[model samples]
Target: MRWFIFIAIYILVDIYAFQAIRTLTKNPWIYSIYVFLSLAVLAALIYQVSTLGAGKVLDIKSMYVFGIFLTVFVPKLLIVVFMFGEDIARFFVGIFMKVAGSDEAQFMASRRKFVSTIALGIAAIPFASLLYGMIQGKYNYKVLKYSLEFDDLPEEFDGFTLTQLSDVHSGSFDNREKVEYAVNLINEQQSDVILFTGDLVNNLAEEMDDWKQLFSSLKAPNGVFSILGNHDYGDYVKWDSAAAQAENLRKLKNIQNEMGWNLLLNENRFIEKNGQKIAVVGVENWGLNGFKQAGDINKACEGISNSDFKILLSHDPSHWQAQVKDSPRNFQLTLSGHTHGMQFGIEIPGIIKWSPIKYRYKNWAGIYEEFGRYINVNRGFGFLGYPGRIGIWPEITVIKLKRKKPQT
Candidate 1:
């Protein structure tokens, strides 16, 4: 709903901006016609994308319109992309330069154009890379990864290995070869346990049948444990009857079992080896917003003692943010996915990694530790929209947990 409004306004603003640029240029009439027609072409194409089933024709039309924008619209866009950055930089630098030292003020004043260019380029670069990645399969991979390291741990269980995969969205995958490769990657890890945090299929459990045999190939020394992601509930699919949704969820549960995973739903189990015990707990999706269902964390932790080392698998990182981070149960680690880093991001020194998702989960990816608790959010193993990833690669994380040795 918000997206629809944004696109509508974006097209409108694009038309107005292009027309205003045309008024400033040579052959104004010609440019105006081109701008108006390009926008119309774009609008019609976007409408079809919303209503039509995805296929070759729609794809071809989309590329055609995009190519038109990239080529023809570049001029109009640059007309401002070139101008807007300078204006903003100058406005900001001028105000700051007075209070700032002479050299400092001049330096800021000098970099306005650079800053502006960089600001515009930041957005333009990722979006353009996303489009180009579609052609090269540069952003397409069936893996998600994050590493876990524990400090001040038990010597025996410290460096315990766990691998996490999440949001596979098997429905979004088309490359069987890639699926096999992902499975092989998981199997290759010298892991004691493998955890899949959820979204094994998009919305249809049937989507997993073709890939189930492939996924069944993954093995760890201990076992694979999984919990439901939001998509696994089958809410995104249209149902002829409520029974169909129920049936799909049933199939999803069975699919998890068939894949040889311990499906932990608001439950707990203990992994004991060599005189050490670690509790593994999982809960159904209890996101922060409308998606938040009633997943009882206390119930999941019921039988487990607080002194035992514990790991948790919850779907949304936000759930950890809301509940798990400060819970009294003493879970040492929590694994989650569902952010996918927008399946797009910017990378350099400190990446500006954000999707609309950041507004939801501040610790959307990598490692987040606060107040003696930790969470690792996987970027995701599958593509969602535009069928690709850019900057953020799919991950296959191997985390090592080590116990602190006794002081001499």
Candidate 2:
């Protein structure tokens, strides 16, 4: 039924957009080519989606197939919108002319070539943008830096810095060179410690087999700490036995250990400097939207005190809003990455920052602060459903902890 609706919508949009093409060009060859290509794209999309297994990971080939569909469909959808608007106006004009006793021929006007031309011209923008995004925008990595000042921050860790990475859907990655470049970029920050709020694989442990060595090279003096995201449990995959699913998760945990990452599972570790210490608490995946709730904040905090400057690593930002914000235990800062900024949006720094995902998640991207506590939702280190990123590029976040001095 869902597939039926999808095909119906695409065909309807394509037919409407074709009206504009016909108005602009009477050439039979152009019409034949356009219809042929549109049908071919539709067929490919259906085949690609059908082949996707229970895991629904969208590997490299699937990614490109979906990418092609978007490149063609988006522009045509826009053209349909414009053409539909013109039809509505024409309908009203015809009704007015008939009421005024005008001739039938004069009552209804021909479809305007100018309107079709304008619609086609405007539609080209998204067509070209989607193509560019698939080609170059996916690997466009950006380093986001933040210096957060906390009155209770330990003085010994005043300039302490940590880099946070999250949502590495390794199975979706196709370019190893690009992955290597991003790995090197993370190390270049040279943070005191590297914190990974996870989604290490799409649905399998072996997804990371090819890229393990590259990621293992990531170095920080204080060490690299990580926690699981919802995807780590192999929840989306079908297994022959329950044990098989559990073993997949076990392998992922072991892989992280092999790469020298401290896989914190509902536990806390202290980063001591001189005599002062701060807590790094990690929990399993916890989300509000029926997602995995394996995370236990209270258990993770364990013997840590409220006075300790604490950094919490949880995968979904929704966790912060739901539990962390009002908790009696003070989590000074929280880091997460699951939204991926919807992998598409219009962001112009101070001017504008918006994505469709924002309607679902208030703190979808960048940093959010409330009641003197901060959470930076990393835009993600990889892509998922959408093969390419439009505006929200992959992120590597560097956060510097500073102690606020008391005013005299």
Name the runs in model 1 displaced over 4 angstroms.
1-127, 136-155, 349-356, 406-408
Q: Taking the tens digit of each residue's C-alpha lDDT, what string does model 1 give over 1-408?
A: 965885675666466445334434468677768567766856765765666443212233444455444433444355455455565766776678666744555565446445444544554654466466554443255343444555545556766888888888887766677668777878888689999998887778888888888888788888899999888887765577899789989988998898898999999888887776788899988887678575779888888887777889998988887888887777789999988877666645364655665776698878889877888888888756556666766777678786545568
- Candidate 2 lands at a TM-score of 0.95
Candidate No. with top TM-score? 2
Q: Give a tens-digit lDDT track for model 2, residues 213-254.
A: 989998999999999999899888867889999999999999
Taking all chains together, the TM-score of candidate 1 against the true structure is: 0.75
- Say what the RMSD of model 1 is: 7.4
CA lDDT, every prediction?
0.72, 0.91
